[model samples]
Target: MALNLTLKPFERIVVNGCMMRNGGRKTTLTIENRADIIRETDLLKPEAAATPVRAAYFLIQSALIYPDRRDALTKSAQQQLAKLATVFTPQLARHVFEAANNVSMGEYFTALRELRPLMKRELEVLGPAGLDPTSPDELPRIPT
Candidate 1:
C-alpha cells in the first residue's frame, strides 16, 4: 500500500525526520514505501504541550521526528502513560494503556492515534483550565 499526500504551497512535512516543504505550487506526493511522515499541521510545539495527555502526544511525536532517540522517547512516554492511567477514570485510562501498549510495540503512530481522543476528553474535563501553565506531571523535557 502507499500513502498519498496533497500539500498546499509551502506546506511542510517531516519524513523520517527530514523536514520538507512544498514549493510555490500545490504538490502531490506518493509515499510508495513505509516511512514516518508527519504533516506540519500535526506538529505540536513543545511549549504548547500544557496538559499531561498533550505532553505524551508531544513525546510520541518527538519519537517520530527523532527516531534516533526513539528508545528514550518511548520509555518516557510509557512512564507518562503509566502515571496517567492511575489518575484517569477506568474508561479514560484504557486509552492511555492502549497508547502505551502501542508505543511498546514500536507503533508510535498508533500510540498517537490512541491518545487523540483523550486530548478531547481532557479538554472537556479541564475546560479552560487546560490552557494554564504546563502540568507538573507532564513528561520530562525531550531533547530537540
Candidate 2:
C-alpha cells in the first residue's frame, strides 16, 4: 500500500531518519513502501517533554526516528505508560494501554496517535499552574 502526504510551504518531515523541508510551494509526497515518517508539527523536542504523557510520546517518536534504539525506547515508553495508566482515570488510561500495545507490536506511529489524545487530556487536567516543569518528580502520582 502507498501513503500520500501533502506538505505546506516550509513544512518539514522526517523520512527514514532523514529530515527534509518542503520548498516554497505546496508539495505532495507519495510513500511507496514502508518507512518511518513523522511531520515537523508532530515532532516533540526532549526539552518540551515536561509531562509524563509527552515524555512517553517522545520515546515513541524516538523509536520511529531511530530504529537502532527502538528496543530501549520501547521499554522506556512501556514503563512510562504503566505509570501513567495508574495515575489517570480508567477511561483515559485506555489510551495509555493502547499506546503500549502498539509500541510492543512495533507500530510506533500508531502508538503516537494513541498518545496524542492522552497528552491533550493531561494538559487540560493539569492546567498551567498544576505542573512544575523544572521538576519531573512533581508529576501526579498514583494513589496508594
Candidate 3:
C-alpha cells in the first residue's frame, strides 16, 4: 500500500519529524512506505494551542516530533486531559482517555489516531479557543 499526495507551491509537510516544502511548481509525492507525515495545513502551531484539547493534540504531536521527550509529553497530555474531562462529551471523552492510555503504553501512532476525533469534537463544542461565534471576522479554521 502507498499514499499519494499533491502539494501546491511552497506547501509544507512533516515526515518523520523532518519538515519539507514543495518548490515553485505544484508537485506530487508518492510515499511508498509507512512514515509519520503531517501536512502543513494540519500543523498545529504551539502558539495557537489555547484550549485544553488543542494543547493535548499539540503535545501528542510533540511526542511524535521529539521522541526523546515522548514520555514527558505524554504525561503532560494526560494531565491536561484530566482538566478537559469536565467539558468533553462522553464519546469524545472516551476517545481522549483512550488516546492518553495509548500514549502511556508507547503506542504513539494509535494515540494520534484517537486524538484526531478528540480535536474535531473539541472544535465543534468550543468553536475555536476564545472566539465569539457571533462575530464573523473572528472565525477559526480547523484543519482536517
Candidate 4:
C-alpha cells in the first residue's frame, strides 16, 4: 500500500535535518536526501547547542523590567556557573559571556565568574535551598 502525506507552509519535517521547505508541496525523500540532511544537521548540532547562553541572555535581557526576579535568576545561574567554574576554562568564560551578553546579563556573568570559587567552598555550609537551582519555570509569576 502507498501512503500520501501533505505538509503545510512553514512546516518542518526533519528526516536527517536536511529541512525540506514545505511550500505547501509534497517532496519525496530519497536515500541521498536523507543522508544529506542527517550530515548537515549533525554538523550544525554543536553550533545549535552553543546558543543556550544566548537564549538565556535574551530571556534575561529585560532585566530592568523585572529587577528582583532577574536578580534572583542571575544569582542562581551564577551559583551554578561558579560550582562548575574550576572545571571551566577561559574559553568557557568567553562562551558564558557571549551568551550573557546576548541577553544583557553580562553583569551576572561577571559576578558568577568572580564568585565561583567562593560559592563552591561555601556549598557545604549552605542549605539544600541554597544548593537548589532555580529553573525558568520557577521564575516569579505575574498576575494576568
Candidate 5:
C-alpha cells in the first residue's frame, strides 16, 4: 500500500533556519519595540523625503552594524522619526514602515540589512543629506 502526505496551505515549516508558510496566517510572536520596523522602511523613501529618512536610516543602520554605537544611534533614530512625523503626512511618510507585532528582532534586523543597498542608492540619488524644509536648493537637480 502507498500513502500520500498533504500539507495545509498555511502550515508552518522550518528548513535550514528559514520559515516557510503561506500568507494571512497569524502567529503567537509579539514585537514589543517599533524601532526595528522604522529602520527597515525608512530606507525606501523617495528623493524628496530622503534627508530625514537618511538620518533615521543611518542611525538605525549604524546601530545594527556597531554594537558600541547602538544606544546613541537609537536616540538619533528616535529624534529623526519625530522630525519626520512633523513634516510629512502619515500616509506619504516612510516613518510608518514598522514590523508587525509578531515580528522578531533578528528577523527585523536581517530585513534591514537586506534593504541597505536600496537605501544607499536612494540617498545617492537624493544627495546632500540633512533635512531642510525651507531650502529650495535641496530639491534634486535633474539633467535638462
Candidate 6:
C-alpha cells in the first residue's frame, strides 16, 4: 500500500528521522513502505510537551528519532504511562495503554497516533507529580 502526502510551499516534514523541507511550491510525496512521517507543524517539541499526555508522546517520539537514547527514553515513557494508566478515564486509559503497547512493540508512529485523543482535551489525570496539565497560563511571558 502507498500513502500520498501533499505538502504546501515551505512545508516541512520528517520521514523516518529525516527532516525534509519542500521547495517554494506545492509538492506531493508518495510513501510506498511502512515509514514514520510527521509534518513540521505537527512536530511536538520537548519543551512544548507541557501536558502529561504530550510528555508521554514526546518520549515515544524521542525514542524513535534518537536511537542513541532509546533505552532511557523508553524507560521514562513506560513509567509515565504506568502512572497514567491507573488514574485516567477508561477511554483515555485505553489510548495510553495502546500507545504504550505500541511503543513496546516498536510501533512508534502508531503509538503517537494513539495518543491524539488524550492530547486534544483538557484532562485531570494526576499522579505523584500532582501537576495540573489543564491549567491555563497564569501570566503571559514574552519569550527572549
Which candidate achieves the best lDDT against the true structure? 1
Model 6 clashing-pair count: 0
Candidate 2's C-alpha lDDT? 0.82
TM-score order, best first, reads 1, 2, 6, 3, 5, 4
lDDT of each: 0.86, 0.82, 0.71, 0.38, 0.42, 0.74
The reply for model 4, stretches above 4 Å from the true place, is 1-68, 97-144
For residues 41-101, could you state the per-residue lDDT of candidate 6 as single tens digits? 7767655666667778778887776666777888888887887787667976899899989
Instruction: State residue 85's C-alpha deviation in candidate 1, in Å.
Output: 1.6
Alpha-carbon runs more than 4 Å astray in model 3:
101-144
lDDT of 3: 0.71
Give the Cα error of residue 37 in candidate 1, in Å. 0.8
After superposition, the stretches of candidate 1 with alpha carbons farther than 4 Å from their true spots are 135-139
lDDT of 2 by residue, 33-128 (tens): 998899999998765677888888888888888877777777878888888889888898899889989999988899999998887887798886
Candidate 4 lDDT over 1-144, as tens digits, reads 332334555455443223445666655533432121211121222122122232233233323233446566555444434444454467556555443443343443243333334334344445445544456554433221
Writing each residue's lDDT as its tens digit, candidate 5 over 1-144 gives 222223344655432223456446544333344322232223332243336455455445545444555555555555655555555445434422341110124333543553345445545665654333435565322211
Q: Write the per-residue lDDT of candidate 1 for residues 11-114, one digit (tens) a residue.
A: 99999999999999999999999898889998878877888888899899999899998888888888888878987888888899999988888777888889
lDDT of 3 by residue, 111-143 (tens): 777877866776777776442233433222222
Of candidate 2, the 10-residue stretch with the lowest lDDT total is: 135-144
Top-TM-score structure, candidate number: 1
Residue-level error in angstroms, candidate 6, position 105: 2.1
What's model 1's overall lDDT? 0.86
TM-score of each: 0.88, 0.87, 0.69, 0.25, 0.37, 0.77
